[model samples]
Target: MISKIIVSVLYFAVVFYLGYKGWQNTRKASDYMLAGRRMNPFVMAMSYGATFISTSAIIGFGGAAGLFGFSLLWLTVANVFIGIFLAMTVFGRRTRRMGLCLNCHTFPELLGRRFDSSFIQGFSGLIIFLFIPVYAAAVLIGISRMLEVSLNIPYDWALIGMTAILAVYVVTGGLKAVMYTDAFQGGIMMVMMIILLYYTYSALGGVTSAHQTLTDMAAMMPEKLQKGGMLGWTQGAKFGTPLWLVIYTTIIYGVGIGVLAQPQLAVRFMTVKSDKQLNRAVLFGGIFIPLMTGVAFIVGALSNAVFTARGGKIAIAQAGGNIDKIIPTYIEQVMPDWFAGLFLLGMFAAAMSTLSSQYHVGGTSLGRDVIERGLFKRVGTSAKASQIGVTVTILATLVWAWVLPESIIARATAFFFGLCAASFLPVYLLGLYWKGITKVAAKVSMVGGFAGSMLWLLFVHEKEAAGLGICQWLTGQPTLVSAATKGSWVWLLQWVDPNVVALPISFLLAVGVSLMTKPMRQEHLEQCWANF
Candidate 1:
């Protein structure tokens, strides 16, 4: 504990120094919001990667890997090739150029300017500001669990302390501080994850032997999971089963595609100076992301084997049935005390980097987009307004962390990602390349997508609907589809992600409505596309 405290203090000292540096450099609202649009490629890349892969990836989804097994690695592949590579190349260039053209400071601002509608910007901002805390709480829960298990801190205290520290740097230093600390945190995460993978494989003998042992434990899977379609640690789940749908649709498909539309991640494109910087950042991001998420999933799956070898129990069993506790419990019990201390710092870096960005984005969305631009007639970022927004976001996140149920990290993260994709992707993507996209279409698509996603979550998605109990309260059933259809074909709809349904719905609304509406003004389109 003494060593852990010392290491934590050293880490915080460096972080605070970086925060002070960012604050010192910030001169105007632009500096606070976009780092003067003069960021280094490496820092931008590392910050983006760190913010993208947080405790949600490490502790929340890592713990999911403990139960779901190697199938989760598909998410890493999608995260790299789709989330990092394609997002930076296909979307980053246009977003950066257009943001420059429109003098936009936030994602919603970019969209609103493109559509020439204040309502689009304000509504998008409101969505982000409201839903972001739920996602932030997922990261909060992850780090709090780490502190609770590894450092023996109370969960509530850990949550409060962590949030308070993050609120300071994020509110005062803004994007500059968030990115600097994120780069530093990203480096820590990479080193720790590499060490963890090496140690895990070494402890299990060799790579080949470790995999073989896990493969041989197929029969050891609980009957309940077997019925749910999980095969084993090494083998994949049975296709189209309940487990398979949850794994593929929600975890892989939802999050994989959803990353493209994340307002927090989207705004990073506007931080760099040029397309060249974005191109360079792509290489760094590609390398950094896999090291963070890939290692977590591998170690998480192998935890089951490690626990079973040491005791006669699996990972979830050792964690007292809470999936969120699996990774933290494994680290505390299995790894050396020194490594445990270092791992805690890595988790802190992971959680703080992501949470800081979330707060910054949420705050900007509320202050700059919703309040200053939407409610008032102001058209630029406001430091004072954003500071207030950050405070409220921190409080909202804390409340969510307090109220959310156990084993909720992965679900919450996926929920926000899916929601963003459904609501924003259609308009953002279409408005970028298509001059025919009208204001009415953009507004209709955004509203339709959001409504569709919520409807599915409330009435169709069994896991969420059952937990929310809204459907149960309204119709006396956990899910409307389940009650109406009986059990015969309920699995097909209940297990599908809201994104699969709502994204297409939103896209169709954008296209169909645009075809019927007048095109955007040629002068506005020319101005918006001037950089290109």
Candidate 2:
């Protein structure tokens, strides 16, 4: 117990020390916002991966793997292909170049400056400020739940304690501290994940043997899962089934493509000095991301085998049927005490790294993009506004963590990711590559995407629609598009991902409005397309 206490204390102290370092170094708004756009390759990549592969990935997505199967491995492939490689080369490089050209700091600021529209920046900032807390709350809930299970602490206290600690550094140190600690936390995550992978394979005799063991246990799947299209823990679900749609479209594709437009992830490109830094970071990000996400998913699926062999209800059931609690409960049972303690800190590292970045981006969006630039158009207010934004973010996160429903981390993460893609992906992609993108088009597209996504979530998508029940109450029906339930065309309204539905509308609106509208001022165009 004393040794565990000492290990935990040292870990916290190092994070605190990095926070102090970040505070000491953040001399101006640029340093605070973008690390003066001079962060090194290693820190940039590590911070990016750390921020991207978060507790939501480990605890939430991992829990989903416990329920779904190795089919979630598709997301790992997507994360690497899109999140790291394509993003760094295709998106990151362009974003960094355009950001430098416009001298923009935040993601919304980049769009606003690109199109020369305060509405674009302001509304985007507002969207981020409002929705990101739900996502941040997901990360907060993930790690806090882990601690609650492992340390025998109350969930509320664990949530509050972690949030308070993160708020101190993030609110004070800004982006520099967040990235500095992110890199440190990223290191902890890598080491612990590696150990976990080793032990998992070793315990089940080897990779092949363990996998064979899992594959042979398909008959053990719960009736609910089997009804929902589950085939096996190793093989995933059947094609075109409801569970297949949920796993593939909502979980995999929703988050997979959505990573490209995530405001928090996108802003990291602007943190580096050059495209060279982004390039160097890619290899590391590619490796780091798989280690974190792949290992989590693999472990989650294998855990079903672990618990089942011991004559239990699978991972989620072992954690009292809360999918989020699967990993924490399993970690305690499966690992030695010292390593389990180390892994707890790894969960902290995962949660804090992602949470700090989310708060920083949310704050910067509110403070810099929306207020200083968009609303007030004032100089020297960036830092103060960001501080206030950070406070609001903390409060919002706490509230959401307190109120969110079960199986939240996976759903919330996907919900926010898909929402961002629906809202920003069209504008961001068009703005970056196409000089034809007009201001009104950008504005219209953003609004359309956001509105479309909300309507779908309310009327069509089952999860939030089911939870909110607004659609049910208004229409006197369980779902808005009940064609399948009632055998009508209205079922078309249900089931499709918001991104699939919203992104296309956003693209068409952007292009249609751009074609009809007068072009942006030539000099604004010159500056935007300049130096690229």
Candidate 3:
């Protein structure tokens, strides 16, 4: 406890000093919003990776791995290939060029300018500002729960305290502080993950022995989970079953593809100066991302074997059925005291790195996109207004952190990521490459996608619909899908993620509507592609 307190205090001291440095350097709106478009490639890559892989990836989804087992590593593959490599090379280069050409600082601003529609910007901003709090809450819950377990701090206190610390730097120094601290935090996370993996394997004897032990425990899977089609920690789930659907659709497909359209992440592309920087970022990100998600998932799954060896219990049983608690409880019970302290600091880094970016993106979305550009032409870019927006975002996140159910971290994170994909991916992708995409099509696709995702969540998807209870309240059924006969295709639709359904709808809407509508003026199209 004393060592934990001392390390925590020292960590805060460095964090505050970095925040102060960022504040000292931030002299203009550009510095606050885009870090003056001169951020280092290493910092940019680390910031992007850290923000992308947060406590949600480490604890929330790590805990999910504890439940679902090694199948979740598919997400790590997608995250590395799609999220980092392709995203940086294919999307980042163009986004940076286009943003520079148009002098756009924010993701929404880039789309709005590309389409020449302030409404698109405002609407995108509104969606981000509203839904990002939920995602932020997921990260908040992750670290807070870790604190609750490792330090004996109250969850509420940890949540509030972490939020307060992030708010000071992010609100004052903006992107500069967020990215600066994110790089530092990312390093901490990587080192801790390496240590975690080493210790885990060492505890279980060796890599081959550990995996063999896990494989041998296949039949020992809980009867309930077996009924739900779970195989074991080593073996994947039975295909085409409920457990399989949840693992593949929600955890893998939803978040894997959803990373493409993240608003907070998209903005990071615009913070660098040249394509060379983006290229370097891709290399760094490729190496860094696996350490974050891959290690977390491996350790999470292996915790089952560790627990079984120690106490004849699986990881989930040890965590008392709350998947969110599995990783934290494992750390508390298994890891050394000093390592737990350091790991807590790493979790704090993960949470703060991600939360800071989320808050910055959410705040800027409202302040720069909605208020300044959408509602009033006279109100120029104001950091003060952005600070106010950050405060509001923080409050909303806190409420969600308080009210959101236990084991909701992974689901909420997926919800926001999938929502972002449905709402933004079509327009953002098409607007970058295709000259024929019309403003009206972009508007329609975004709104249509958002509506489709929400409607499905409320009516069709079993997990979210049942959780929200709106469908039950209105129609006396947990979900509209509940009315379907079991074993039918309609019944199976409940397991499909919103991304699987809505992304295609959004893409078709964008393409179909663009073909029918008049294209943007040739001059505007030329201007948007100026850097290309």
Clashing pairs in 1: none
lDDT of 2: 0.90
Q: Select the stronger candidate by TM-score from 2 and 3.
A: 3
Q: Output the TM-score of candidate 2.
A: 0.98
Count of clashing pairs, candidate 3: 0
Top of the candidates by lDDT: 1
Residue pairs clashing, model 3: none
Q: How accurate is candidate 1 locally (lDDT)?
A: 0.92
Per-residue alpha-carbon lDDT of model 2 for 1-532, expressed as tens digits?
5666688789999999999999999988888889889887799888999999889999999999999989999999999999889889988988999999999989999999999988899899999999999999999999998888778889999988998999899999999999999999999999999999999888888999989999998998889999878999988898766688788888989999999999988888998877778889888987998999999999999998877766777787798989999998889887788887899889989999999999999999889978888865766798999989999999999999999988899999999999999899989998999998899999999999999999989988877887899988999766766636542335534556787788899889999999999888889888987877
Q: After superposing candidate 2 on the true structure, give the runs of residues whose Cα lies further than 4 Å from its correct spot.
A: 376-379, 486-493
Candidate that beats the other on TM-score, 1 or 2, i.e. the better one = 1
**Which residue pairs come into collision in candidate 2?**
483-488, 483-491
Tell me each candidate's RMSD, in Å, in order.
1.2, 1.4, 1.0
Query: What is the number of backbone collisions in each predicted candidate, taken in the order shown?
Result: 0, 2, 0
Q: What local lDDT does model 2 show for residue 103?
A: 97
Instruction: Estimate TM-scores for all models.
Output: 0.98, 0.98, 0.99
| Regions more than 4 Å wrong, model 3 | 375-378
| Two-way lDDT contest, 2 vs 3, winner | 3
For model 1, what is the error of residue 223's alpha carbon versus the real structure, in angstroms, after optimal superposition?
2.1
